[model samples]
Target: MPRRSRTLTGLLLFTSLTLTTAGIAGIAATANASPEAPAAAAGAHTAHKAAYSMPGMPGMPASTRASGDDPDGDGYIMADPPVTGVTPSMEVPPPAYFHEFQAKCAPTHTAPDDPIVYPGQPGKSHDHTFMGNTTTNANTTTASLETGDTTCLAPGDKSGYWMPSLFDGDTKILPEGVQTIYYKSGVTDYRSVRPFPKGLRYVVGSPMQTQEEFKNLKGTVEGWECGDSFKNYNFPATCPDRQDVQLNLRLQAPSCWDGIHLDTPDHKSHMAYPVAGGANYNSCPADHPVALPMIEFKMAWPVNGDMSNVRLASGTGYSFHYDFMNGWDAATLDAMATHCIKGGLQCDPHGYDENHPGQGAVLDENYELP
Candidate 1:
């Protein structure tokens, strides 16, 4: 993902956080799904999101953030702005926390279904490798997601995350090790980063896209990884034969969202990437003004060495796409944004920043529900 642009001087505030349980009681939850494909692991916040607004949006009933900035006049403000030159590294940089938090997960199952696109109809889509919400399928619903078993470290992360299944020759392969999914502040200001609404669903990338089109996507970080080197948009012809290191795919979701609709016919109309200002992204487009956590997926594939035949079920390596359905424990997710993001710190899968080990926002004892 492109770094926040300094071109749009001053600071921009993200508003519009009015999460309510209005749909089917069972399928009702936070409708927060970004266009980026984050390998989500943090327990998803439950469905009871308070009817409150973030910094730049109206109706800010209460705010834990101290009063400091009001770029768009939403009562909320930014006390301490983001550090100017701190570039995010693919790997977490020790104890220093950035404006980010993460969840780690492993594959739970595979199916030829997509609840968001072809709901209630299994086998309507291509085979997909799923993580989190173990029971995710074509019939998956918000209620089902909340109750399904999870592979993520955070118990609250009931959300379902998946990508087209990958294959080596004719045999299917799965990702090995823990997959880290990052939810970060997409806006330059982190104080107002709000949690996504429940049941929110969105698609990132498309199997039908051409290689050039995939390359033009703002959030595309297309590539494979083998130890120290990682620069191939398509799988490298080969990789070092090793166990410690596996092939990886890191993807990002668009951070900006439209406050109104949770989803649209296209599944992507409600979300958008930050617009370019100079060389970096400076602000969200007017249509998608709400700046939510930028979802980043660092998927770890099991294949190594022989990369002569590795491809996604969707098509060529460039035909990458993924899906997300918000099903987090509402309270937990909200706190994560409060302490880790608004507090401006990089956090672990449980939203804990060891460097500032004070009792701030963090995962509860079991990292899950009772």
Candidate 2:
């Protein structure tokens, strides 16, 4: 994939008094519009933002910073700055918990058998490991997702999450254990957290940039580690003599939304991340007021040495990106967010359901790679 680029231009137009009056009249006529009016407005704004690239903006590319710029100068990028000052919301009671669920991995090839990949273009895409819904694809819609079969231990979860497949030569490597999903608040203000609206979709990270570009570019989140005991994001982790090296990758999707648009034309402008300074770590900007649960991807890939042969469908490890399509039922998602997340109760995988007990169930817990 190639990096997307666009030139920014500024123009000053002088309108005649007669034209200006006409424009004002049109605006006034549309001021008291119907509920559908906002959708049109959001679409126009999204289109404009896509045409003008804004580097270093939150939903845009990350800003250039030197301290963590591959401090060790190794080929791999490091982790991002740790999230600080995350004081759980006091309004919510103690024991704020996460809803855990396990799902089976699906192949991400474009082939017909690979349902998660876009339809009709099989060989065009590289292999990826997917989880969540079993029927996701290019033609998948919000309605279709609601009705699609799920891979999650809890049959109710239909949302899909996926990343590039780890490989050694032509063989694919699966995680040592079942891949788990942890849904919790990234900040203390749990009261403001909300469920992901149905049909919401977004992509984090870039597939076109190189390792150097990923390391130096603003907004890119990539890192590596050895074993499970990791310390800082300054350097790649080193594996002990017998253990496999791991890539500790984290990609945080934008949480704040403009509220009206399920997705923007740029697929990002409608959302924003919490700023790094002071106590505003999870604060959403005024324009993007509605706060949705932040989706953070923390993955460990067992790829030890010689990354030269390690390549993703996008590029290399540094070019990692993932796609999410919301398929969760509205009421159930809302309850989990309100009761478990906001209420600070670590509910089981069944997600606040009374019938299912324990910490939910793990799907394919016994399954292993061939």
Candidate 3:
């Protein structure tokens, strides 16, 4: 696709309003001097009723009741009552465990030719910032990826992940210390979670105008924030004076899979995000019972100034999306998922369990990225 320019005023305005409202609510709750607060009392009542609700995923029923009665007896009823389930355990892999990986920043002229976009047409897609497998391109296939050299710390890993390029005016900015961290937590039962099946491919985020939608609206884990503090997704952060405008783009892949299809026609129908707010928050759907390690991509770019001039080949900075092609050895990937992720142990790039030293796979200290 050809490069395009976009405006961010609407997104910024919506974000600002949301933050302001949240801040006001916090202040109001704090300023209320009455120990017998009505809001708190109401919340306690709702929480008690929510305990008995059935478990369900988004767009699915949590209970047999067509709808539940409004706790306050108001005419409008709330969303399906929250369901009950285990929450996924999450942690950040340490920097010491960073894999010895490297890839040159790909120019717009070198967009990959993969199933996610321009599947059979080379040069039909926009430029992307690629990593992991070095030979990813339009002609890459499952078989080709299996035999590809990987940039992962683990020699057995051949997965490839990439996102749109970040540009400041006419200059392309590259991410620094491009580290990939793995997490094993999900809302589903740990026993049901599994490693990514080989050859599975999918894309997260969108290249369309809807890309500007916030995480809650999109129902996906994606956002833009400052590199220094990547957690603040409420708004796009600004850099302090004299410092480069370093921004972080985060896209978290779906952890729930259907267990049957390695890929669907749309490349996404078989996968779903863990529910966000029910008793089953972050849990997988019944149809997609296999819980997999959640893969999150955080790309930090140096914009160097105001974002007004920032644009991506897809559209605007907010139009960010990413692709993932799983090429892991099935046995090794499964073991890592079962022993490290599901085991609730933080592992290094080589799959070494940091919690229990000497356990899990060890990296070749002498090995370097090709």
Candidate 4:
């Protein structure tokens, strides 16, 4: 994986623009898989991620964070946010949660008749070793535990293989209604998504009308190229690539949605149709469960050498999530208005679900969204 060389100035400016335009927070998430050669955990580890800090909220101090760490043994501190008296709507039980799910989620289906092939083994070569790009022996209980069952699956964990650990064995997976925006590693899909900042277009679902209602929003958008072609392994086409291009931006919306609630549609069932005579348009679900007015975008790609900026390359994606306060675009805004009104939901900053929490008359601080 390569380090990006974007300056704080561009990130800061984009952050401001995103916040104002979307009435939401801006955020970024990064993922890095271990190197290709197998080595003991004690071996020299080169894989690493850079640190990032969010802008301060009013009445908040810069040096505030909770004590404790992630029980998953990822080596990163999973501290509580600074905002006191606040808790996420999602109720993820602590360490006990993992141990419990491990037993329950254990797959009932028998392993495939073929022997598991470990990737990156010294003299012994395998399809996953080179093409999948990781040194983790894909054939052991430890690997399963580390990867969370077969969900530890290399690129396309989202769909293929039916790994049970990802859901932590909980029968309740994110509702099928949840939709996810995807950039399939290969394929000329670039034409389907446009760069941001050309100007935000109102999504068809917003509850608020009138230019006046949306007066305060603004954002910036960019796109990254994932080399030139698509190839297949055992994974799904939508899996993030190790060397995919990245797009980063910040956005903000007006007061009407500020502190307002929005709904998140069940994106899984939505139909994908290529846009008019152009590219295939994937129609997102028209309605969502929660209406949210703001969101942030962050993306990353794998680079062979040290990288300070975007470069044409071939690889997979890490992770993409949001920071509820900094950025958002028109599509999110329209959904916010429409869903908030229809679902009667509110914005919950501490929400763990994919959408913002805290709004709606039935506001349950402990509720979790997918």
| Per-candidate TM-score against the hidden true structure | 0.71, 0.60, 0.63, 0.20
TM-score attained by model 4: 0.20
lDDT of 3: 0.49
Indicate whether candidate 1 or candidate 4 has the larger TM-score. 1
- 176-219 per-residue lDDT for model 2 (tens digits): 43344556565546677767765566555545445664564333
lDDT per residue, candidate 4, 94-193, as tens digits? 2210100000011112111101111122222111111111222323221232233221111212111111111101111111111122211011122112
Best by lDDT: 1
Worst 10 residues of 3 by lDDT: 21-30
Q: Compared with the true structure, what per-residue lDDT tens digits does model 1 show for residues 30-114? A: 1222332222211110100121222443222222221111223222212122213322222222332378988887777766677
Steric overlap count per candidate? 28, 11, 5, 67
Tens-place lDDT per residue, model 3, 182-216, is: 55555434554666766677666555424325344
Model 4 — which ten-residue stretch has the worst lDDT?
Answer: 97-106
Candidate 3 C-alpha error for residue 20, in Å = 29
Candidate 4, superposed: residue stretches over 4 Å from native:
1-221, 224-270, 273-346, 349-363, 368-370
Residue 118, candidate 1: alpha-carbon lDDT = 55
Task: Answer with 2 or 3, whichever has the higher TM-score.
Answer: 3
